[model samples]
Target: MARFEVPDGSTVQAYRFALDPTPVQARALASHAGAARFAHNHMLTLVKAVMDQRAAERSYGIAEEELTPALGWSLPALRKVWNQRKTFCAPWWPENSKEAYNTGLDSLARGLDAWSRSRHGLRSGKAVGFGRFKTARARRSVRFTTGTIRVEPDRHHVTLPRVGTIRTHESTRKLARRIEAGTARILSATVNQDSSGRWYCSFQTLVTAKTRPAHAPRSSQRIVGVDVGVRADGLLVVATPDGCEVARVPAPRSLSAAQRRLRMLQRRAARQHGPYDPVAQTKRRPSKRWRATQARIGKTHAHAAAVRRDVLHKATTSLAQQHQVVVVETLNVAGMRAKGGVRKRGLNRALADAAVAEVRRLLEYKSRWYGSELVAADRFYPSSKTCSGCGRRKPNLTLADRVFECDGCGVRIDRDLNAAINLARLGEPADAGEQGPAGSGPVAGRGATRETDPAKAGDAAGDEASTPHHHQVDQTGTASPQGEAA
Candidate 1:
């Protein structure tokens, strides 16, 4: 992977604000985004055509040198070709800034690279497909790397190339103050329209990050384990090594709460003339009423997402600043939400509403920002099934088992609290000195299955870095044999 090693104590950050543009400014912004879409579709068509022609010639017994010339997929090569054909392809391109065209080409270039790498097994995670042409319904966005991108002095407006100065929905005083102090430098600006037709401007900046403050003393040597769950009353359970529950953040359930309103808006839109013609197998212009209904639906979804994100951000920031060592479990959220039978759909929905995976992501970065240590327990550590008091593993545990009961020590506790306690122990100094999950103790039955976690392998995992918790046991009838992360 390519990396940019910045100077010490400097990091890239973004300040995003909502835009409140007049009708004329809005139209101009939309026009620039439309130009970007046009350039992308036109270039993609050409790229595909050239490849097809070469393949056809090969089948006709043409020599290698006689085949069609290869067309480069890189941004610079695309731009060269674009300039040669723009006279005829887009005569009205002068109305929009050149960065608009560059934005589309850059997007296509990156997509093509990712797709090629994925086809050759050079990339990880999900495989990328070929780039798709941007249609009218596609997302509208453009980036400006140069040309008069600045936050105005009043902190109420921003200046962009071709768009002039546009009023902002919120104050930009925070970013403007940083710029005035020379602590932050604007790198680039991106303008995008959301599904609700609201425009937002995000300023990416290179900022000097302040080190951990010496004035405010942090809770040093303290480890707090965070367990994320989908339950309404216990979205997050934070516990210490001594079985003390620090905080229990109740699930906001924003998406679940707005389901009724979303359903109503969707039904209203379905009754109107929409963009799709099912019988003709083509797209048509949607009615104004349908568009209005869609905007409302989009607004509802956006609101839900904002609420969930806000809650998560607050919870994570508070935890990172208070604790010296924060331990969270390694969860395969993608696999959890994978296509499952009808019985698993509700579980998946609840997990998504709670944004269980986002907890680890937030803590991972915020820990660094606050000069705290972040640790991820191994995926197969069995935090929930293992008895925090007696160190007994219950392989018969199921997802329906909300309360953890240990047969060895006869101890009972809340399932999430038990998991959090186990996680907290993983970050302890004594645990780090130990050899493995079982330490230097005697062996039991067959050991459990072990696989290196690709995501958390680089994290400071302490002693339980993908370590086996309990001896291998048959989990044939168990709903969640590995752990309670789901």
Candidate 2:
């Protein structure tokens, strides 16, 4: 059976295409989105009621599962509830498509499951709770699948499942060719409204390419170490051998400037004095001019995000295409940020700008696509403190020391380059004796053992990673290179 796994070698390529939607299509989208919100809110209410009933039952020595039927945990059961309550749905809600209603319940189901799991400490990320009834701005933030799904062409538009006879602002691309070649498969489609108030349909497609492996691994198939930093295009590209510097893309323009602008917009919005009554939770829509300005501010933020994503994609693609094996140091971003919570907004934004997670994720898929290997070193490998040439760990190393000075080998090198070289050294196959400290670390819980769940499997696999002899692979999920640089 086919299963989902993180991309390992370079094999995956993604393309994001812009879309154009017509007026009818826009209306359909609005309905679906609204219906989705309605379903989510309704389900939340149902769940909360069940919880309250269960709590009351427990007070009287009763059980929880007895309330499941009223809660409607299953999709079909929830749909039945929605069908019965259709009359109370918003007037503007679309009547034709059941899919819109289904979509809402789908989201609610996932949200419910997440909230349930998190409450029991069985899920990652921040704990979620039943959301408050949503309004326009807050409700707009939802993720929907948008892949290569074909639409039935009609006189003035195309028919979609939940959204019917929607017009397109632009014609479809070489879809006919894609269909003929049989390489494209429609995933799902999403209707998004831009800050410009323009609607677009984004279709996600699975495009297949006959990717060829790189011509023979560089005789220096020796691992290449990478040092990720916030200085260059969010990355400080260093080579393993001789601590060579390869790429130095400047930091993309920062969001700080845009953030200031957004703050100004928000402040202005807050200052609008009207016949506003605090007791009544209502507000008059802003003037057209004000709305225009707000949109412009939103557009600015969007542009910055686009630039960051584009740059990351290009850098990751380039790295994946060239190397047989990649080595990178595992960084403890969470731990590093813990001490600086006050400046976390800026730091977190910077981290995102660096796109460290995206790079790692992309490398996994790209490496699989290219039949290359990615080696991650342990978090405690001390890539920064240790000398690249010698196994001397500099306990006194400080962040201020951009250049590494090794007391043992009397060698000096750029800190990033040294780390990269160390990471590259770890790419070589290792013997049992050189398993390193990480491999020999203590095990607890299900430590590196078999797991039935996918999420747990990932954690288990991570625990099983052993430190390499040359460049140590550490617990932080990065690989350090060892030996003489390159």
* Candidate 1 global TM-score: 0.86
Clashes of each: 0, 44
Q: Work out the TM-score per prediction.
A: 0.86, 0.73
Cα lDDT of all candidates, in order?
A: 0.77, 0.54
lDDT of 2: 0.54
Q: How close is candidate 2 to the true structure, as a TM-score?
A: 0.73
Q: Scored by Cα lDDT, where does model 1 land?
A: 0.77
Query: Candidate 2: worst 10 consecutive residues by lDDT?
Result: 443-452
Write one digit per residue (lDDT tens) for candidate 1, span 1-486.
222334556655567889999999999999989998999999999888877777788889998677766667666777888999999989998999999998888787677766766676767989888889998889899888889999999999999999999999999998899899999887778899887789998887766764455555665437888899999989999998888999999999999999999989998988999999888989899999998899899899889988998899888888878887788888898888887879898998898899998888777656666777777776666788888887888999999999999899899999999988887776764335422444312211122221212222112111111111111222232211121110
Best by TM-score: 1
